[model samples]
Target: MSDSSDGIAGIPHPNPLRRLTLDQLRRRTSVKWREYPEDVLPLWVAEMDVTLAEPVVRAVTDALALGDTGYPHGTGYAEALSGFAHRRWGWDGLAVARTKAVPDVMTGIVELMRLLTGPGDAVVVNSPVYPPFYPFLGDLDRRVVEAPLGPEGRLDLDAIEDAFHRETAGGRRTALLLCNPQNPTGTVHTAEELTAVAALADRYGARVVADEIHAPLTAPDATFVPYLSVPGGENGFSLMSASKGWNLAGLKAALAIAGPAAAADLARLPGEVVDGPSHLCVIAHTTALREGVDWLDALLAGLDENRRLLTKLLAERLPAVRYRPSQATYLAWLDCRDLGLGDDPAAAFLERGRVALNGGLPFGTGGAGHVRLNLATSPEILTEAVDRMATG
Candidate 1:
């Protein structure tokens, strides 16, 4: 089959990929839809509004039909990602022998961080990042050092170097948690920027752990360079999955890849950690990696269309609200500082516009005058959302 969200141009469904409808979607139980009352339009969560890729549904359904559920097994999870990396990102060094299956991306990230740091240690992160990064690391007794992003939304290397130096000043080893195609901002890190980061990490003796879960949702034309694929990255760890890309968070399966030098650290992880991934989740993600490419292409197309629609809707309706089209993922970071919505723009939007959005304050430092809007929905809903914000 060719790369398409639907195998064919047109198909029958309660929610066809290209033409998503909220009427058909509110029937579900995802947090995005269920978090608020019917009167409130939900646009806060990272998941999409499109129907599941046909292949993913089939894989999970067939497993349940045959009662194939059990403890996770085999190297299929790693092998699937390896093959996907080769075909999708053109990186082929993913050896199944060097890979391990984790229950989810966040779980894998914390575990890898443990291998590099201990209690009271620090981790350098670009501010206004994924909200969970703070608490997740905090749960492990790790402190976070902010290396705030520049106004243009790109990596601030000087700030990163300063933070890295400060973290290591205590003679304590730290880990650099990188969110490639950075969350909230959707700024795809250039190969040059990443290489410089790697060099900096090497100089400071800090380990690098990249949460690359959003790598698959990258736009068709925007190049996504895998963190471990660049120089000085041979020892960095990469966390990836089909969960975010395919909207399979409930399945809970992810892969953790180690660069050649870091492969030995894989042995440091407790064997019981492998018990995290559900057996069926493995089957679903493996199927997505191997067979869900076409469906993914279609989803990307849908997101691209929604992002463009948001751009026009903002320009015409709420010109005061500044939004930069994301280079990757369906999440849009809005610079609402100009909207006169006070320190917390999201609160104003929810109270006046009846729309739900992620508050920027919780994301740290640079997030004070911003809000995160999920664009993974039908254009009809998107246009209405903008209009509500405009008239409110």
Candidate 2:
């Protein structure tokens, strides 16, 4: 609750969660469904098919109106970000001083991947992860030590521990990039699970870069325990954004927080890496934290409703498609091994049903026989998608 810069409030960071009304979402030009003519439901990308809060749009518009689209100063944006973290996660020790403005979560990830380990070194990621995790590590010439997640998309602690030890024993420095409220599966790691991961990473001297962008979107029943808070925790980094929850991804706002230990490592790296798109993101993020809570709560309720609706309809209509219930995010990881779509059901879904969901195989080596559906759309569209896939 301390200020990081002059004139910044010592406390009261903005709350960044909000939901858009149906009519409001319908009106937004950025809404994907409004632009596409294919009639193919866009449940593929993670962007919400909804309008942003009016305040965000206005702030961005005002910025453009003023004709000062210059790059943003970093310190000016810390206050709202600090408040957002505090309000969303009850993170008490989080101060404005620790947060860094970034262009997007993926850019932060790539930078952290470079900062933590050298190319040809290994970085650990649990499957089926967000597909980009692979390229983020691989593009840097780093190896991906894939630890397959357990049934129901649970993180297999034993496999993770084994991977950590094997890499360390081989004289390689490895880092674990965890997706909290994991995409595709929408699994929010439990406290005990996170504690276990922290212990293993600590033992191996590995860093855990927890991607918590989806953490704010978790269902009411689920709890998101930040990875670094556990015992034996070493260097930890948390990457987040209002883009995921508030559907302002196109505005390009994201945050990355590195603890004291990790900050030391970062100090040795180039300064520009931390100085991401601090300006534009700052406006949307500030608006989201200050005035977006009501909309976010409504969004969670809608996503929860959609989750239930999809589950029920899948059980009743598409008996062969097994959709494991999720604790966070609108994406549902499905077992279509029974669907007879052969190895890739995502391709089959698109070709046969005109649905453009993400193919699961790219998530990891273990992701074959699976597909991920984004249920963050209207019930009517969801129903139609189900019927299209099932009837075939």
**Highest lDDT model number:** 1
Tens-place lDDT per residue, model 2, 1-392, is: 32222112444322222234445554555555554445465577787755456567777889889975887775645676567667777766455566677778898888878878887888899988899888767888989998889865789999999899988886678999898978878899987898889889988988889898887788988887777565544478888777787777777867777776676654554567666575767787777766666667667877887888898899888898887778998788888998788888888887777777777789986678988888877777778888887764
Query: How much is 137 displaced in model 1, in angstroms?
Result: 1.0
Please give, for residues 1-392, the per-residue lDDT of candidate 1 as tens digits.
54233365564223334455678788878898899899889989887787777878998899899999888778988888888888888998787887888888888889999889999999999988998999999999999989999989899999999988988986898889999879988888999999999999999999999999999989977999998999999889988999988889888988888988899997677776767889988998888888777778777888888888899989998888888899997899998998888879999989999999998999898999899999888878888888888887
Cα lDDT computed for each candidate against the true fold: 0.86, 0.75
Q: List the pairs of residues colliding in candidate 1.
A: 5-298
Q: Model 1: which ten-residue window has the lowest total lDDT? A: 11-20
- Candidate 2's displacement at residue 265, Å, is 1.7
The residue ranges of model 2 lying beyond 4 angstroms of the native Cα positions read: 1-37, 74-76
CA displacement after TM-score superposition, residue 391 of candidate 2 (Å): 2.1
Report the number of backbone clashes for model 1.
Answer: 1
Q: What's the TM-score of each model vs. the native?
A: 0.96, 0.89
For model 1 the local lDDT of residue 304 reads: 87
For candidate 1, what is the TM-score? 0.96
